[model samples]
Target: MEGLALILLYLAIPGLLFSALQRFLAGKKKSSSTAKFPGPEQYPVVGRVHDLDRFGMWLKFKEWADKYGPIYQTRMLNQPFIIVSDEKIAEELLVKRGHIYSGRPQIRSLIKHKDGPAYSALMDRHDIWKTQRKWCHAAMAEAYKHHFYGHVEMEMKRYLGLLLLDPARFLDYTREYCGRVMSRLAWDEATQGKANGESADQTLHCMSVSGPITNTMTPLWYLPAFANPWYNFEVKRESEQRAWWLNNLRLAKDRYRRGELPNDTWAYRYFEQIQREGNETLEQAEDQEIFASCMIGFLNLVGVVTISGPLKFFLMAMGLHPEWQKKCQDEIDRVCGDEMPTMANFADLPTVRACLKETVRWRSGVPLGVPHQAERDDEYRGVHIEKGTIILACEWSINRVPEKYPDGDNFRPERYLEPGWPTYQEPLTRYPNFREGHSMHTFGWGRRTCLGQNIVDDEMFVFGAATLWAFNSGPKTCPRTGKVIPIDTTATNAHVILEPSPYQMEFKVRSPERGKKVLENYHSVLGKLKL
Candidate 1:
């Protein structure tokens, strides 16, 4: 009877669904000493798998950190993971010991996908990662200079116009704005709008699913083919993304051969590298392919979702706190008057920038900086972290540490400006909030930090500044209760994105003159865009 019941359940449940239970059952016999560190006990195959949610597992680690102190150890699905919440410890591991700590785990999903090795953000640190990051670093530096896009300022004004017309579709506009900007930036004159939209939509859906977590779990990777809906979903989209990616590459390559591609954009720069070396061999081809992969992949995984999530949180926060909104609006009006917010004037409008910075700290997109894996066995502060052990510089917890941020959970931008508080040094931009001290940890640390941090900061401020300047965004009063709808910062969406749940907010034109200027800018800006 027991055998029959077991067989029946196996038939009913998919192999992927059974992966966690199977690992747990298989891990019953193994044990770990955790030595002197304070952490939950670890079993063989499952280790600390039981302690974490199969999705957004870092949140569970935060709960454990509350119990275990700043540094804690746990094993997930037979893989070991170390969580670092303190800045000092994070510096020792991710910064000082970066050689070993910079590596990304060799997750099966990142490996088997068509362009995974060449383009994935979650790639293990290797020659490819180094090569890809080096090129990306240069391109991103150019991209940070808003002038590089030629007509980016115009595009931004058009974005504001779109928002003013359809404030309710703010989320959709954000996705579209990033989609086109990235598409044009990557492909130059040749781009597929439908392909870009498809990539964004598919990747966005991929974000909402449990694809990443399920794939990284040790035992789950080997699940039968039929049970891999999560991996399969991402893989299919990647394949679709590759189609357009390869097409763009082909067009750019041909244009480069004819000396038609621009010098400033990534498309031209990548092909120029190839033409300079005069080595368009198989390896170079693969490198170019990976470059293409990285271009779309970075835009897809990092660019679109990164900007859109924070903007959502920014709107939610501004609505929840009216005083901040009014304060920012007054600052924007004083700084730019009837003109759309410009990066040049960003320093003068600190209040709007502070609100955006607070939103970043309050609910970061990648709360746990892209998971960095240990290259080999290493010890930090007497704790043993084995080779392949995953290390998360828990940005969520680090940003919220009470010692650094007083009343840490409270949404207050003023904390960063307070005297005697820890401050980070700003190099290229004047946004000290992101650069100085603990708050800067949102970009992660050491070699594995976010490559596009600068661009995200500038774009976020422009959007926030423009939105706050022309329109009023605040909590919408409930029709039934006759009370303002409460903003629930505590409630988070699935996966690593820490955005507030969908909430109601009111967005109305604050000034007809300013609003008219926005519409005029949109119309004029489109004509000015060189692209």
Candidate 2:
């Protein structure tokens, strides 16, 4: 009797009916929300979730922007989202009303609040965010400019020498250059002067690899199932790495305890500021917290924005259009003659700067700039956008708008040379590069705009100017095919920050004499800046 009853319950007809009924009811509830926020006209509970996979989200976004004007609403996984493609709408929602929208969507599985583990700064826009930003800003202030510049010049010469030695592996060479720059900025130590190649390579490898991996992971967490299991696991991994960095920082703190910590770049500045404020003791979490913040801030600018994205674009541009490379080198030759484009040349070399701007616009690594969520319910052109709606500013669309640019899609640098045309259709009132406008959506909008914008602009200038001055870049011919296949600039799509597709190109030194001249000039001017 007991066995028969167990079998009936295990394969119960009533149990199966109940399960089906529960699913049907849940589906009905989801279907009910679709009627209110109609997104692309979907069947019952299916909604527009499938459409995203069918048509790439960004491409679909482009189509939606065209059909529904600058601001439109959609639903994904039953979550209502707002897309704002127009710059004006972005300014109004993300900038003017930033208080409500500045908060980030929580991805709890990825951004766990652990006992002692430190998380990335970009993960939270809270009290620590303010503290970290303020400390970094003052640390890299005007006074330290010369101190850091002096170090940078030495590294620049070293980098130029390395590039000349091995013209191939320009990506690796550029990474090496950026690593040295960032290390100097962070610790006031030259990467080349470091004891062994092992430590330096470890640092470089971390910087290079972390960019794409984190970029990939941050977005993946939004997808269900895939990002769920790894939540605590990732937090533990991050904590372990943070522990290592904290140990190094603790040594610095210990040295400071004994009054032996030498004043240098960022660390020096931070300590000086703390001393000046007359606050000796810090929070228990200060060392670990600061290290984590600095790592994120530094990498957000140097590893991801400054180096990976722009360096890849610079390489691709040089690879695709070798003429631009020659033109830049020629300009360098004419402007500096035997001297390299240093801090002084930066002002004078309008063409080279223009070329950098062109590269940023021509192959913008950030296609759909970071999405801004509306803080409160808003109305735009009769469209009622509810709060929590994610808004996208069409950066790629803005760059490729035909009305704003004559040959919008072409990679021509000369358009900028025309009087009153350096910025294409961008209004003169707004910043043209990196952070643009009252509500420029590239760096981001309002208080959330990238904190490291200045650092990025400077680093990109250095990397671009240095590369164009030194080598020629483009595709290599396959002996069998005898056809020149250019680097694919269209390999950009968003995860968090869009990245260039992996492609091969050759880097060759134009002239050893010219390279020596640039190095000499770099050292001479760099010594004066002290930065």
Candidate 3:
């Protein structure tokens, strides 16, 4: 009798909750003025959750965009989402009227600390986000001016050496390159090894559990703590993440006290700034909040996995489209000439720049960008968007706009260089530059745009140029079949951040001289460091 009673109680809870949710949604639907917008047909309680794929939801979104025009609506349970594929709509809503559309959608799976203060800038809290953004901008600006180039160059050289040693491990080296550079910039050399790969695993794990399908299942959060798997997993990961952040923070602070860290490093700058401006001026005065916010905003959110996506795409592009690879190498040879390329040579290497731009457009890191929430009821094109409606600017669809990019499915660096393409411009020396507001929605839109764009651009540019200069990447030939090993450029991991499904390629040193130059630069940088 007790067992039956317990079973009945468990069943009754969800039934009662579902009834309440149905009533709430019915009221919302009656009041909603957004019915005029085209959308996929949604079921009663689940909304469109049944229609969406867990990992490949971005592809489904692109398909829906094609069927329903530029702007469309979908629901996940009681939450309404507005997906914008048109760049103009994105610009108008997310950029022009950013104040109304910059709030982050509340994902129940991501709510690890129910009662603790939100420490990530990714949260919806405006005041704390403002303070975090200001600190990030100031520190990044100072670092870029004084220290970022050296760190990137050092990492690029190390990356090249690692790739040359074991060409099959290019993907691993790409990840390591992004991780080490971010670690160095965030703290110092001492912390780079400890923070690089482990943080990446944590970030990816967090993203995996907090994706579209998991986010939509709001009922999971209402269950008892013992019965809730999502809540339990999130709690465990959050605790591990917090411990990692605190440990790194303690190490960095100890190093700072010893005068071992550079003044331009983000850790040094952040510590100095907080000490100068105490609790009265800051939103996050607690040490744990401060450390978590800095690390979460800078390293985990913007740095490692985000940068690795494009770099891997670039490598894939080289293997799949060797013609473009040769074009870029020829240009590098003409301009850089037997030396590894640097930011100083960026202006003269338009082909290299175009290839990098094309790679980003071809495979954006975040296909469906981080969702933004409407802060107030708003109207655009005679359509009403409610206060809490989630907004997604689908980067995958935006990049494939037929009118903007002809044959958008194919890899073509010439689109940015040729005369007639929509992306092209004159004055070859400066045309393909990312700094001139020519972004194709790669970073993001408006005030919420990534603060790490400058660093990302620099890293991509230098790494692309140096890699093209050092190695000739081509499709590997099978030993037995003798046929070319096929490259699947379309294959990607299904996380929110789109990473190429691991693939192999043949990376041969372009010339002995170039290989020697990479080795010399690696050793030279190593000698300069006291370690």
Candidate 4:
């Protein structure tokens, strides 16, 4: 009798939970079904997979977006998506109609595993996204534009000095700067200040989890991780790494409890607010959710490949093309006269700015950029696009579009100097080089744009200008004769991110006076940093 009763209880409990889950999902479906966008003529199960299988799908997406107009739809993984590429169309959906479109797409497996609310920026647009974005904006604004200028300048000086000493070590220097600057920001100090050894270790571990290791391994997702017995081992390895990352989060949580405050990171501010609210639920959300958000933000390192890639391209371009280097240095010398180029002097240094802009355009930081998934099925002209599709704007294609930018492959800063060019002279001019779909969508589009855009810009500009001012860049070997070559911009790869192939370069100091000045200010500036 007792055994029968236990069986009945088990069945009843599961049935109740299943019924409740069904009802919840049904309500969610009803709420989300209000909008319908255009899509390709494919059965629901197959969606737009056939259409996107073509070679150079990147270029094809822009062509389709133009043909389909704004507010189109498609599908992927049997999910509905909306695509908006034109500026007006993106504005309509992501801005004016933001209430409906702001919600991020959901990743089922990720959320099912409760991986702290899906890390894919392309997925999971919800209230959590809204909350995290709010905190991120505030944090970026506090650290980059206003608060962290001193640290940024110090790093810029170090980078400039390195250019004079060892050009071959450029990659290492760039990586160190990226690591240290990001580390400082993550740990909340102006420099390499550690609140505690465990906390610092936690930060490092969290970073390594998402670093190049995960990057190289992530493509394995294209293959089956489990289910197939042959793939089980790889899946287990990924699982182990994920577990380690979660443990690091727990360590961060403990540090928070111990009053280990971070002055540089946005997490500290948001978590503090959570604690101050005096609500146990909010406090929990603040601790866990905020930690999750920082992890997301720390994914900035993933995007560093974008910045570092282009910086090297710019350096190589300078090294190969000595004439352009001389022209830029002359302009810099005329404008700032060795005062260490500040943002205030940016306007006077238009030519210098143009070089950076042209560098970004010629060899964009992120060539493929983050892909935008369509939320609805929509059409422009006569193209047939379906819902739940993945669309790419292809920055390289658009930036190199001969019609929009004539002689697109050549590096010409003068084109932008014209009266009506996008970044032309204006009281409030935006940098043309950063990203171009709106604040240069190089960061991203719509609700999932990069939160670190401000710092990325400031650091790139500061570093680019400072390095040019300190030394003249040129290639060290000859291409044809196998002798000393010159750097050539056209040799860059148009991949996920545009970067110059490995090349040697020489950095010759423009003047002894400037060299001494950079050397004198380097350590003092670093000393002032609250490391």
Which candidate number would show the highest lDDT if scored against the true structure? Answer: 3
14-131 in candidate 1: lDDT tens per residue? Answer: 5435664665454443324255567788764456655565446657777888999898877655466788899899889989999988876654554442234545466666666666
After superposing candidate 2 on the true structure, give the runs of residues whose Cα lies further than 4 Å from its correct spot.
1-39, 42-46, 53-56, 113-125, 141-148, 189-229, 254-262, 279-304, 420-440, 479-482, 492-494, 515-531
lDDT of 2 by residue, 353-382 (tens): 667677766766556666556666656555
Runs in model 3 deviating more than 4 A are 1-35, 112-121, 147-149, 190-195, 208-213, 275-301, 529-531
Q: Per-residue lDDT of 1-531 in model 4, one digit per residue for the tens? A: 335433433444444456446644754664444444554565433355445522234455555656664446655324445555544455554555444443333222121212233243434565555555576577667775563635667767776666666767875676556545654565433233211222222323222212222211222223344422213533453355445444445555566667775544544655566667784333454457545644534343343454666677777767766787887788788888977886666656666666777777776665544555445554434443344344544565556555456776787776666665554544324434353322365665566677766666666777777888887666675556878774555554333444455667777777899888888767666555553
> Candidate 2 or 4, higher TM-score?
2
The lDDT per prediction is: 0.67, 0.55, 0.74, 0.54
**Alpha-carbon shift of residue 308 in model 4 (angstroms):** 2.1
Q: By TM-score, is 2 or 3 better? A: 3
Candidate with better lDDT, 2 vs 3 = 3
TM-scores, one per candidate: 0.84, 0.75, 0.89, 0.69
Indicate the TM-score of model 1.
0.84
RMSD of candidate 2 to true structure, Å: 8.0
Tens digits of per-residue lDDT, candidate 3, 1-531, equal 335434544465566467758767765875666445898997765578666776677888999999999999988666788999989999999999999988876656766322233334366645556666676777777667753848788778878887888998888888878877777776665335435655565555555523422454555456688866657887776666666666566677778667786775677777676678773333444575544544543454357777888889989988788888999999999988988898889789999889988888888888888778899888887776778888999999998998997888888888888899888887888878665645547778888787777787689899999999999988889999999888778787766677788887999998888889888887877765423
- Order the candidates by TM-score, highest first: 3, 1, 2, 4
Please report the candidate that would top TM-score against the real structure.
3
